[model samples]
Target: MAQDSGAPEPDDKLHDECGVFGVWAPGRDVARMTYFALRALQHRGQESAGIAVGDGKTVLVRKDLGLVTQVFSDADLAAMPGHVACGHCRYGTAGAKGWEAAQPHLSTINNVIIALAHNGTLVNFDDLRRELIDMAIPFRSNTDSEVAAKLIGYFTQRGHRLRTGIAHTMRMIEGGYAMVLVRENALYAFRDPHGIRPLVLGRLGDGGWVVASETCALDISGATFVREIEPGEIIRISDDGLRSERGCRPLTPANCIFEHVYFSRPDSVKDGSSFYLMRHRMGARLAQEAPVEADLVISVPDSGTPAAEGFAQESGIPFGTGLIKNRYVARTFIQPTPELRQMGVRLKLNALPDVVRGKRLVMVDDSVVRGTTSLQIVRMLKEAGATEVHVRSASPMVTWPCFYGIDTANQDQLIAANMDLEQIRSRLEADSVAFLSTEGLFACVPPNGYCTACFTGAYPVQIPRSFYEEKFLPGYEPNNLAPASKTSQMTLVQAEELLGQEG
Candidate 1:
């Protein structure tokens, strides 16, 4: 939905692209299982929700522009009985918005049908789309996800197995992605070579299997977490049992570090540690690095609560709630009147005067994006009688844009990209402002190769020159940490020859 001309600006934070889930279980209500899983993964996206089920004969899909609960009624789930299914909830980063762009994108290859849900941006999709269009392939949406589904279908129809088609397609797409696909009789899951986006494998009751973008989805669906889907790996689950294949050669691991700082739910576990623990550690580290004298440490709200608690514990300050969020205020189509528009952040959050009055406050938030929301929040705290409001970010300053699944602004709109620490503090009108150091952020998470591009301006994948030219300002340049590996971008002829050799 387009924002009204006079609507209040959105919160200054990065948005993740989407969440994907797949399940393969006979005798289970696969549709309902997917529905619940999508609910758990809802935080990853809110623009649209969809589910596709393969009932042993044909793939059936239902999708629309709304939250998961808004899109799927109990009756809708009951209507889509199947043994295998895939679901998607999307906040589109690489496509136009509308019902057409809602995913679990469906396509046909000969007599076979498949539905796919994807969770990242494809940096080279524009070129690939043009290539496919030149080949007379039809397209329903401008999303890279549709390109993927059709690309897989195109390869499959040319006398290749579905898994091989998927493998070949994986070799062609460039960017951070985790995808879940469902055909009439099986479920497939795959990830990009760098593992820049997350996908987890899980075991359902004795005979079932599940894959999702996060462990929280698996938890809600009564699935036990097994392990992460390896980078460049393809997982196929069918009646014959589970199969895993190396769809492409794995490159240096570059998992998105933001997952620990903000994206994943605090309760979600990664590398044997809960995100909550990692964020808490980040808070402690932030406190050590940027200590301040304040009577109370308060969080921006739900996302910042864990870090705020740790900050309080480490600094020996009392932790209290100075701001209360209106839980029911989600994205709305209804435009607020001019008076309400001026209220801005107040529509979603309100200051607790009884808690903050006359106290010096240290307010911790997960991150600072454009700084507009932070400025309003600081003003609100002061208006509520706080003597001072110190803003602390648990994550490092986001100085660069993300071309992966995250919906970050161009460099010009990112406050950190344009301002130094002192300038940012002045801009936000906060008594003080501090961000966690990049090195400190890395210390809090598990020891694994991570994508710190947003903090360091070092990209793991080679962005298309066109994309780079379009996204970066004139004076800015990016550091290509690792370009696309040779084997990752296979030619059609090479892919065909390899498939023939396997045959």
Candidate 2:
């Protein structure tokens, strides 16, 4: 018998890289606070969860291949008590999906110990890993995060302070990342130069501080939102005080727009507005751009609810629940036969005939990746007696692959990248299908620089030729917004030479 890999059935959805949480609080249960924060951020990643605590003397880490709830219990939390801690929930985009690949990754520098929780992919980590291997630095996993931890350890072992080592590592590594690191008595947080990922700073009571990938995590931990961690900024919190420093020069801001369209929880705030409102505005703009005459406006459950309500409000169509999702059906480790595998979507969602029967439904979804789920959902709705099923995507079409932190398919696998609007509608067998225009999407979010690479094919960070050479189909060229060669702000040789000069 073939053993199941315990991975979720392959679906047509873009996955965020991971979620990271860090807190510096004395005379409090920091581990439990981190656990609750990770639970709130469970939507960001589900494959693994881990927490590392610094109890003033040494750093302790516990991690495994499971959800946060599954990975820790009351006793587990009680065993690990600390003043500073960091946690991670992973939906891996970079390396193997195994116990060893789970983070917060731990590394040592002589007498000092540190653990790192990261949320993004490092584009140039392959070369950096090779360099570290050549220098005889051992690695426990084939993950960019592990490489990052080892790089910091290597630099710190060379007589530099931990913060200095981190700054040097920030200069040498390239990609979109939001990282939270913890040593025996201090907590550190930083972001990449481009700010392609999200990280927020929050105040916990009078003497504590917290940082997380989303504001929702702060809400769960009773932390008040302070502000976003600036691009290339490093924040350190310890007994002495909280301080901020520049890890590297900030590049042009390129926040991932998908966080507003999807990824983030509805209640999470960004730029003084909730993601629910942003998505609602996206649906309203979408309705203005692509209006369809339908008797009912229904969403694909939780993710698309706000958008569907906005569409209904804009189009004067009555909104109702047409599909019910089985909340418990997250992932199944069972191996099914071919015929049973075809019925996979049925295991997660079911159509409500009483509500949708004989009604013309405009089904709104977050986005269509490969169109497989949309097609199955359309057929299911029709089978449940929906008169006509018109599909509406709340966001613009995804035509290019995301290299920063999102786990999107290759260019050839994306439906919009390979087919036109009519072709997509035909393939899904829907009455009609329409997506939000890119301009309309921009109008819905706060005015700021964004990485529209997945929709516009214009990459903010330079992608290595060796990395993306075979990722695209023939004749589909990517627009490199940044210079094509060096992804890192400072090369490893330059950094090492600078260190030599300092010596």
Candidate 3:
């Protein structure tokens, strides 16, 4: 479905740009299974959906720019008969959109079909893309996932086995990626060296195998959770069963901390910790770190409910849903004007005057991104006659952008980046505001087990300054992207010359 170009775009939330699901079930409807699992993981992305299925002899792929339900109909799933399948939901991390940017990205090598779905961003995408372009490898989309797929295809055609090819590509690529790829006979999954994104393996009751971005997908597919694919591990699944390899040397694991704070479903588990429990712990810690006097604890809804409950439990304040979310309203719309964008919040959530009237409220939310929504919601609560609203965030302030999979704002757009806690409180029109301390956040999770770079700017992966600028300025033309005077539209000779300079 096409978005209305004239509608105001909702711009409040942080979005993870992709989710991946894969299954190798010989006797099952793998395509439908993938559809269901993708639905379970849909919160990670919304721009597009795709599935690629493969039997022993043939691979079939269908993908489009829509929600998972809109893209794959029952008829479409029924037509794709296969023993192995991979699915993807995407949120357009790169500037590109439409059908062209949808995954599972398909490529052919030596008559073998390969379809891949990826869940993270590549920091060195320019370098890798330049290499592929110089080699005259045509690209279907402007996505780092395609670069990875083409590289894997290139190596497979050079006499390397599929697993070997993927392992080699992993070595050459830099940045966070959790990927699931399907070939005619098998399914392959791997994660980046830092594991900035989450991928987990699961077991089907009928002796099949599954791998997905989160455990919730397994639960929906009736698969039992097994374990997370290690930071640098690769696993291959075929009729002969599963095989594993250490694709790259492990760096300190940097599993995204936001997965617990926001991105992941509470039902999902990562790194042996339940995301729900971690979030609850985070809220409890927040209450300890920033105690507040309040008559009621209210949540922002859905994402904030769990933490709000924890805050209530720790503070001995009653927890109530003072705001109700309109489940049918889409998260985003094409708001063409700033005025309409500001009004869009009421369409998504409404304050309950009866619940909040004359009450001093402690409102717990997962995190504040740009602070626009926070201000709007606070103002809404005030209009409903709340005496005071104290904003409490379960996570430390997000002051930096995420370079992994998450679609975070540039530092300039982040409210915490430009203002202190008191300044943010004033801007949000709240009586008081406090965020979970960084140390409190670490205490809530496994020690040194996750990435807090968005809060601390301590990126586990070294990043070039240019990558940050490239995200907002699409078609970024830097000397590193092209050579001295060459543009991306240059011919093969120009790309080759650029590569030669790098060599």
Candidate 4:
């Protein structure tokens, strides 16, 4: 077993915002089910975990900064006795990372307690926050999800029902989101107009209702997969039954393509297609586009496994596990210092000398962000006696920042944006390197149904110039006094400080 190098692998890939799960089951242990379901969707986030359980008359929430396993204990789950529960696994996209930023943000609306778990980013959070703060609404965190919850609460407190408040809130917010909210007596789940995030509804064998970010959560909770919650639709569940209503008319179906390429767990299915199968198809497409002659095909396990299998099968090459991952090293407490990061790759994955001894290798990975990790992998394989390493990527090169809830907003940090394919291959010490074509990616989803903004620079929504500069280049002030774009407005932090003080 590879011992921990005293640090986790530094961030090398685009990160999804979060994962949400909610359950409404009167007789079942909804809290435990939520915990298990969140455990299944942990891949979506690792920064924080939270669970909010609501009985008929009261709601209790517990959240903290850590992995789900580290945040909640058996005693904690047992203490949360309720018929309704909402859980979240978070990786902050719109807010500064902190313990207080954990989700299932709780608020009171017309004295009705609302606890919400969100899995997307909102572009107009700053605008919405300005509106709410003007109404004297107090805020506890800087996250966009909290802004959204407050917007809904504001309307609910003004004589509107929960459903109507949510509808109005949806109209005011823009961007990608899949949300699950629990009230004192009922549970509500909804998707944004664009459906850039994934949310699915499932049925438990014991007459319970489950909603989650992926079907894998449903499988873990012993629930049968139900249909996906349509974009612009809101579903409410209570003792009476489940009811759905259109929250807003969808502009277009802009599902995040990264979900299929890298975010989702392989065992999970989305849009009637298995995530693993989609990666397999991407690999096959890569094989057809960039053919290579190698003795063996190896994956950068475990995200690289499906694509490598597809590459090997399509190319008629033998597939083998050339790298062994230290599963326990996934979420380590080790600090990611410069020295530790250089050693982190070796600690997470070690080359199998026996598998690659004197073999020409075709290595497949989901995608590359900085190329440092890829360089380390190629170096390790070469040190283990691999004659050659041909690197292949399953997704097209990511050259633009994602403003719809992914953590790839810095173009300078993106290796592909700064280097050509040959330059990248030279940096990684690979014999050759190739990425799947954008056309190949479009083939993986329904026509005009996916967002490839990061790869093609075709943003589905307008972005503010300040937003881009804030993520890509800090400390540089814009000379123009006007906003960056028509859609690019102030952020909540800026809006709060600028729109007069609120104590």
Q: Which lDDT tens digits does candidate 2 get at residues 48-79? A: 99999999999999998878889999999999
Task: Report clash pairs, candidate 1.
Answer: none
In order, what lDDT does every prediction score? 0.90, 0.89, 0.83, 0.84
In the order shown, the candidates' Cα RMSDs to the true structure are 2.0, 2.1, 5.5, 5.5
lDDT of 4 by residue, 415-472 (tens): 8878898999998899999999999877765555877788777766656564565554
> Using alpha carbons, what is the TM-score of model 1?
0.97
State which candidate, 1 or 3, has the greater TM-score: 1
| Quality of model 4 by C-alpha lDDT | 0.84
Q: Model 3, range 1-503, lDDT digits (tens) per residue?
A: 77556745435568898899999999899999999999999889988999999988988999988788888888999999989999999987536787878999998887888999999888767777887888788887788888889878865655357876776677667777999999999999999888888899999998999999999999999999998898889999997889999876777777888887889999898668888889898888899999988999999988988889899999999998899999876434244475555575787899999999999999999988889888999999999999999999998888777777777736667788778878998999999999999888888887756777787777776665667663332432222211221122344345334434534
In candidate 3, the residue pairs with backbone N, CA or C atoms under 3 Å apart (3 or more residues apart, or in different chains) clash, namely 7-334, 7-335, 8-334, 8-335, 9-334, 9-335
Q: Which candidate's lDDT is highest?
A: 1
- The pairs that clash in candidate 4 are 464-488
- Please list the residue runs of candidate 1 whose C-alpha ends up more than 4 Å from where it truly belongs after superposition: 1-8, 487-503
Which residue runs does candidate 4 get wrong by more than 4 Å? Answer: 1-9, 336-339, 446-448, 470-503
Per-residue CA lDDT of candidate 1, range 1-503, in tens? 86568754767778899999999999999999999999999999998999999999999999998899999998999999999999999985545889889989988989988999999988888877887888788988788899898879876766468988898888888999999999999999999999999999999876799999999999998999999999999999999899999988898999999898899999999989999999999999999999999999999888999899989999999999999999998766578887788788998899999999999999999999889889999999998999999999999999999999888737887899889999999999899999999988988899999999999889999887886676776677889877775543665556667667777
**Winner by lDDT between candidate 4 and candidate 3:** 4
Candidate achieving higher lDDT, 2 or 3: 2
